[model samples]
Target: MSRITTVFDKLRQQNRKALIPFITAGDPEPALMVPLMHELVKAGADILELGVPFSDPMADGPTIQRSSERALKYGVGLKDVLSMVEEFRKDDTGTPVVLMGYANPVEAMGYETFAARAKASGIDGVLTVDYPPEESEEWVEHLNRQQIDAIFLLSPTTPQARVEQVAKMAQGYVYYVSLKGVTGAANLDLRDVADKLIRLRSRIPIPIGVGFGIRDSMAAKAVAELADAVVVGSRIIEEIENSAKENILTNVYRLVRSLRSAIDEAGSKH
Candidate 1:
């Protein structure tokens, strides 16, 4: 099994959901990236999604946009991100690292080359926001050949047919955008999320991770009750944005610890 599948299987047996945390690579500061990644795992993150800084992050909100901008200012590109992952692997080989970003950088690096480099760097998954399943056949093939999961996104507006298409092509877990808008959009409406998850569960066989609007422990716990994982990005980015460099690690750790506690409570109830 892939590292992702193995982690999900273990979580299932323990009746606990995954806590997947995202951080823009080289955000806050380029020198802090690897340390921050290790801190997240220590803070109870099951899977880690490292955002690749892009010039125009269409899917991200202002918080993450700023993060990408900060990283870009430091000249942190795909290779730098991959090097970070390689450094992270020196200490952590168990936790899966998923690269979350746009398609432009990958295209520049080329699919096969990117996949080969990603695998060598110990990356376990890739979730390109703009890569639709209809056009991802060869891309998915390339990553699959490298034994890296090509993860996909499913929003509330995704058609049923497309969900099935994604189910066929995607590996690891499916990311369900809990809100209709971009990342950090508010008004979660767990009732709507629950209803949608019922349909998604009927379609997607692998684990489902809910994100986009889960900004606090309450929403994280509620979504944890329904999905296989809870992915928190923007709120964490906001934490990074406001904290002093010396305290960013501690502040983020505390936030994730609280969310982890809430999600664990939900699993106990489950």
Candidate 2:
């Protein structure tokens, strides 16, 4: 099995749900990234999503967009993000690291080169928000050849046929958007979201992870009861944004640990 598959299998065996925390690689500062990553793992993050800063992040909310902008100002490019991951993997081989970003930079880097560089840098998987399943066959084949999982996102609005196609193509967990809008939105309905995820679970073989509108421990715990994993982005970014550079690591550790325990408790109740 792939590294991602193995990780999910272990979580399943323990009756636990994965807690994925997202961070822009160079947000706040690039020098602080490795320390932040270590703190996240120390606080019980099952998987880490290292976001690459893009010029136009269409899927991200205001918080992540500002974080990406901060990263860009620091000259955090794709190569820099890979270097951060390379440094992170020197000590952390157990935790799966997935790069989440847009396709514009990947295309600019050339598909084959991007795939090779990502694998060589010890990245386990990638989630390109704008890459549709039908249009991703070639890139998916390239990444698969390099032993890297090509993860995909499925929204509540995704049609049944496309959901099945994405499930068949997705190598890692399927990212199920909890709502039909951008990240950090309000008024999320757990019952309606659970029903949508149940429909997806009936069709997909891979683990399903819920994101978007999951801002606090309570929301994360609720989502964990139904999905295999819970992903938090904007809230973490908000923490980083609100804190000074010296305190960013400490804040992230505390926040991630709280969410981790919350999800674990939710899973236990199930």
Candidate 3:
């Protein structure tokens, strides 16, 4: 099985929800990327969603956009992010790493070449924001050949027809954007999310992870009760954005650790 499938299976057996944390691969600086990844694992992240810096990240809000800007200021690209993953694999081999970014970089590198390098870097999954399920058959084929999971996103606006298509093509897990707006937007209604998930679950056989407006432990705990996984990005980026250079890793570790504890608490109730 792929590493992502294995991890999700293991979590299912343990009656635990997976905690997937996201951070731009080269944010702050390229040198600090691997260390931040290790710190997240140490703080109880089940999977790492590493963002590839791009010039125009339409789906991301200001917090994550700023993060991309910082990483890009240092000229970090797709190859650099993959290299960071390669370096990270030198010490840790089991944790699944998913590349989350726009499709431009992947297209620029070519799907075949990108899949090969991603597999070489020990990447377990890819979440290209703009690759709709209808247009991703070839993309999914390449990743399938490389044994990499092709993750997809489903928002509140996603139609049932598209949900069925994603169910057929998406591996790993389906990311359900908890709200309608961009990454850092506010006003998440748990009732709305719960209702949407009930409908999605009937069509999607894979696990569903909810993200976008989850910004605190209370929110994470509430989400953990309703989804198979909890994905926190903007909140973590906010933590990174507010921390000092020397304390970035420490602060992020503390924040993620709190999220872990909260998620575990919710899991125990389950």
Q: Rate the local accuracy (lDDT) of all candidates.
A: 0.94, 0.90, 0.93
In model 3, which regions exceed 4 Å deviation?
Answer: 267-270
Cα-lDDT of candidate 1: 0.94
Provide the lowest-lDDT 10-residue window in model 1. 261-270
- The sequence of per-residue lDDT tens digits that candidate 1 reaches over residues 1-270 is 899999999999999999999999999888999999999999999999999999999998889999999999999999999999999999999999999999999999999899999999999999999998878899999999999998999999998988998898879999999988889888788999998999999889899999997899999999999999999999999999999989999999999999999999995333
Q: Write the per-residue lDDT of candidate 3 for residues 23-65, one digit (tens) a residue.
A: 9889988999999999999999999999999999999999999
Report the number of the highest-lDDT candidate: 1
Superposition TM-score, candidate 3 onto the true structure: 0.98
Per-residue CA lDDT of model 2 for 1-270, tens digit only, reads 777888899988899999999999999889999989999999998899999999999998899999999999999999999999999999988899999999999999999999999999999999999998878989999999899999999988898988988888988899999997887787678998888987888899999989999999999999999999899999999999998878888888899999998998994433
Q: What's the CA error at residue 240 for candidate 2, in Å? A: 0.7
- Give the candidate order by descending lDDT: 1, 3, 2
Error of 3 at 111 (Å): 0.7
